[model samples]
Target chain A: MNLVIVLLIIGLLMIVAGCWCLMRTFHLLKMTIGIEVAMKAVTLFLVLAGRISGKIALSETFVITVMVAEVIVAVVGTGTAVGLFRKYGSMDVRNLKQLKG
Target chain B: MTILSICAHGFIYGPILVVLIYNLFNHEFARKHFFWFAGTGAVWQILAAIGGFTALNQNGQTSYAFGAFWDIRLAGAAFFELNATRFLLLLIVGLVALISVLVAHQTVDFNRSSYTNLLMILVLGMNGMLLVTDLFSLYVFLEVTGLCCFIMIAMFRSRADLEGSFKYLILSELSGIFILTAIAFLMMKTGSLRYADLAGLGQRISAGSGQLEDLLVYAALILLISGFAIKTGVVPFHSWLPDAYQSADTAVSILLSGAVNKVAGVYGLMIVMQLFGDVAPVGPSLAAVGIISIIIGALLAVRQPQYKRVVAYSSVSQMGYILLALSTGTTLGLVAALAHILSHTAFKSTLFTNAAALQEQTGTLELKDLGGLENQMPVTAFTSIIAFLSTAGIPPTAGFWSKILIILALWQAGSPVLAGVALVAGILSSAYLIRLQRTVFFGQTRPELAKVREVRGSVLTAEVLLTVITLGLGLLYPYILLLLHAGGIL
Candidate 1:
């Protein structure tokens, strides 16, 4: 239980840190790094929680699967973002409003 | 199971398998490949349904008693067990996927492979969700589905879709947190993850020990249901739905409002009730949520200008009716809830498809901009009218019967107030829906709508098929009710 609490706190702090990182200048690489950090925090939190509760680490397999899925998704997202950047010469989301309501 | 029946499971897996097999030979097929793929899926569903019926007749047992396809073993506990309900839910999901693909092929402009591939993954996750019985397994599939939708929405590459997708992702993440924490609590209390075991624990509660355990259970249920309610777009948590539904591409909207919301929200709620009754032992909190959703969703829906938003809010209100009926915990109530789910999917899909087709023609989904469409797209307008009336609970329609059954259940449960509220909502439903039809299709044809031709034959056929099914559901209401009873739900 104590270990789970620690992991949860770590996950919370990592999220806060990731948000802080994102709030800095909107660099794509930086944002990606922060998100990856946050994901790792989440994975660690799940693993520790399972271990502390004497539960089997089904999460180990789950995280590996999710990571592979994330890579595919990130590739698509990055490709789209890059396409938008090339079209408009900017990566800032605030200025990209071709179809806004 | 018969050899043919086992092969039917292969059929459920056929879509993904087809994609993989096709990838081996060629990256692109003829432009009409989706039709062939979807046709195969449809044929698969019919075969599975027929096989399921045969299995029922021959064995005197209807439901397949399969364990969870992917079970996780612990030192002293088993964590998951999927069974007949799960299989049926998957079959329904498979059908929804094929329909969504057809809708996509007809409406959306797929520039590349990403769109179709992501859509299939979304369907895969939804199918997996319905087939998983463990709370944690369900959560995993929920996240998978959420991710798929987030990606699909982002693929629109429009500012509106981006904002909507981000909002949806944030809300979905929050709901994911709630589901996980609630599951953790359930694990803490029951020391098991299987639905059957949790039901056993819930049943084993003696009179004195029932209250605290029930309260904790209620709290967990509240967390779980609220998570699903947000995803389901029920009121209070429904603010995100209009934007998401409006901004998403037409095909995504069909899946979102029709299958995904019902699967993630309504089906999720029903499974929860199967484990723990809907009444939430803590002074009818779930009922309170239901009543508020019904009233608020209807009231807000009356003021919506966008056609898709109106359908979206109506879904919120309709979900309230479902939850209210479920709260009664009677056979009639459960059956009413299930029946409403079937009808809502049929009508809602048709409504959204028509709205999307109209938007494509007239360049706007706003009702104010869409006056007198009946003269332009006769088939679309007629199909929309049928869907709208049925949704508003007109007589001899599936909606009316389900609404009646729910109200009857409410009355049986001694909730005259809710029964009366449901009646008022039904009336309000008619008022707004009728207003929608009159404003959009019955007036003078605007110049903008003058050149709005009927959508392609394929889109029209899809809408008509959905409308026919909606009407057929009304005609075959008894048979569906019987199926529900046979499933031991009622």
Candidate 2:
């Protein structure tokens, strides 16, 4: 129980740190990394839930599935980043102003 | 083994089959006849949904559960379930996909095969979301739908397309993280994320176990609401919506506004309402979000210079109506929300189809660049008027009936103030849509647009088909009400 509480705090701090990185960064690649860090924290939370509930097997399956989905999201995010770079000649998100109302 | 079961299975497998067959063919041939493959699949889905709905109703079963290959008797196994609500959503999915394919036939010039592939996968994903009985699978399928949408938006690889897809991807992923974290929290308390396990969670929370458990539940509620709110593009979290809509291809925009937002966002909220509705804060929070979105979305729409952007903002406003209805947390409220969903799909897709027409004919969707197209494009002009009327809740249109039901539901749910506020918001809807209609279709033809003519072929067909649906549904609404009254659902 003590370990669970400690891990929960660490996981939450990681998520907050990741989101801060996302908000403070203009680099597209950095944003994707931030998202990845936060997603990893979510996976940790899932594992913690499983541990506390004694449903480790179910949560393990969920963690594996989430990892697969996260990787796909990362790949797609990078692919879009590459597309943006080729078009704008930079990875800065500031260039994404073409569609504003 | 049963026909209804086969139809249920078809929702999952049919799109996969379409994707398989689409890729199996050589590129040139497949590109040439992409519509036939995609169109047939959509029509089959429509028929199967209707058939399943009738069969389910006839058997007097509220929900039917089936598995693809797994045994149903096993403990803790995940499976698909279908009921009236899921069937209605499935039917809407098919209808919107068909409309999108029709519009794409006119607009999506390059990368036709890939468009078909991503579209079928999107359908598969939405179908998966609707069919799943567990929250975790729903999240997985929601991500699948979001991924497909991002790829489809960036399919052309233009600068604006990539920008829009990237914005949507980031925010959508953020929402995903929030949802996943909430699921973890909920699971910690309940030991499972299945709908069956979480059905009466509100009572359990109120029954008051430990302090930590209640705290976790409250925290999960907040996360879940915010996560889905981003997807729904409710006012505060709505920045990514118009940009994504305005930047994507019109066919994809039609899919986004007409189907994806509702399924991925509004439908998720519907699940939340069903499970956690008895929780005290859930209702008020949803109501607050709904009202804010309605007012602010209209105010924003009033200023958008682009055609699709206005419609996109209008989507934000309309989503508020659905959420408001859901917030009431009554059977009537759910019915009202479902009715609004159907009517919104009809009119919103009609509006987007008109956007496709205007874009194809006039070469731009800038409201200032367009004028006096009424004389030249009679069908498009007429359909646009009908859609506008429906959108503004004018009489003899589907939007009018749905909005009326929404207000009625709210009033009966004892929030007459919210109901009155909703009633007045119709004027705001009318304010912007009327501005749109007068600016683009009602004024004198600009010199450049003088040569514009009515868009023909599949786009025109989509326009007429959607207009007919709006009018028919509106005219039939009274009978629908009567039937509902007879069935004691009113």
Candidate 3:
């Protein structure tokens, strides 16, 4: 049951989720969720890849490390969102164009 | 110590050594020690480069990692590749590391300890980026660098700076997805994660891959290149750069443009270039990107009202030169690219520091707001003029010689059109840079700005140091090139 199809679906969904977060959502929190969903897809693909290739331990280590890194990135993303909300009075990216040419 | 000892011990451990040293003392106690790390990192980089150069002279390329870190079954490990590309890359990293401490001291005055700590991580990330070889570690180091960049940009948590950092975060995350997907495809196809292994796989593909496999490989290559290009801000992928550079603190801008982009983008491309031997599509596509970035960056820079944004757009143009040089896929082109790497690092860092000085003194980076500080701060005026000239590829500055070399290399490589376009774009950059000079330094001092005085202390020190190097390198490139050739670095 766990095969390349499963891996392919996860990766595709993650890419779609990332695209949705970036292209559709104007809100920072949702964008962060989109990033998390997307990276989870990458993590699953890596582990399944290791399973298929018979290098489960190595892939597991990579997954664990990636999880930690993803968390940090998410935390930073959320923190920045909070900062943006406080300073700009909105979480919308369109409103944050004070530094244009 | 011998090169082997440092490569085996220090190169891998140097950043850790820096981190441990930072953690051993309180932030106040550890603030200036960051300077020591940067200084020592430069010395160690030079030693490692000498070692790498000598080794490459004897052998071709060397890869080293602790055997303990390796799973005997799996080939990839925590590793570093020392070849011509890395030799120059490390030296550039060393230069950025040394300058970053100076930038930190100037811009970060409050809660200095926290600044030092974050900067320590930043330096660690760059050092890792220069040294890491495998694809997985490259992504990790890149993210580490990215995280540090986000924090540094929004360190003050100003409304504008935070937004810039968030934009950067989003783009970087997007690039990350692209890279990881590409990497997964690569590993699934190649069954190995190491560059050496990739080379073997590339040979197999070149010998004759199925149409589907070939398409997959090309798709993966596109994804990987797009990831690096986004980081590099090469033309169509450059929206994040102006925002990031403009909204960040000036010192942060110096470090970001001077060092971070080179490590993350240029070095990333070089590593991937290793995998792309004799691929027919690589060169022409790369050249097209170079030209696009050059023209767009030059034209956009001409209209930028803010000084920081002008320099930022100009960086997009300069990076185009490097990519174009690399796209030639010839040894001379690579050499020219390396020279441009050094030249850009020196001049761009200096120019950004001067921007900092301008901001500190005049309190405005908007060109239309004020002008004519040449009479008040002669050093800033003079050093910045030299930097501007260097950036515009004016003669007697290092940029001039390197740009000429790139054009010459392109011509020799049978691309007269590109060479001519590069020349014209070089002139276009000068037009904007001159406009910049006329507006910022050469104009009449505004009534309110008449009392501006010369900047003193560490900021001036950073500007003067980079200024002298940019000027000195311009006059001294021929000898330097000869030396590099002799050293087997070119």
| Top candidate by DockQ | 2
DockQ of each: 0.19, 0.92, 0.67
Query: Residue B116: error of model 3 in Å?
Result: 1.5
TM-score of 3: 0.91
Q: Please provide, for model 3 over B51-96, each residue's C-alpha lDDT reduced to its tens digit, 9 standing for 90 to 100.
A: 7567656754455443324443454555654556666777676666
* Stretches of model 1 off by over 4 angstroms after superposition: A1-53, A57-101, B1-4, B28-32, B67-88, B203-219, B278-283, B478-490
Tell me how far the alpha carbon of residue B446 in candidate 1 is from the true structure, in angstroms, after superposition.
1.6
Interface RMSD of each: 4.3, 0.6, 1.2
DockQ of 2: 0.92
Docking class of 3: medium
**Which digits, one per residue and each the tens of the lDDT, describe model 2 over residues B69-109?**
78877899888999999999999999999999999999998
Candidate order by lDDT, highest to lowest?
2, 3, 1
| TM-score versus the correct structure, for each prediction | 0.84, 0.99, 0.91
Against the unseen true structure, what C-alpha lDDT does each candidate score? 0.69, 0.93, 0.79
TM-score of chain A of 3: 0.90
Positional deviation of residue B384's Cα in model 1 after best superposition, in angstroms: 1.6
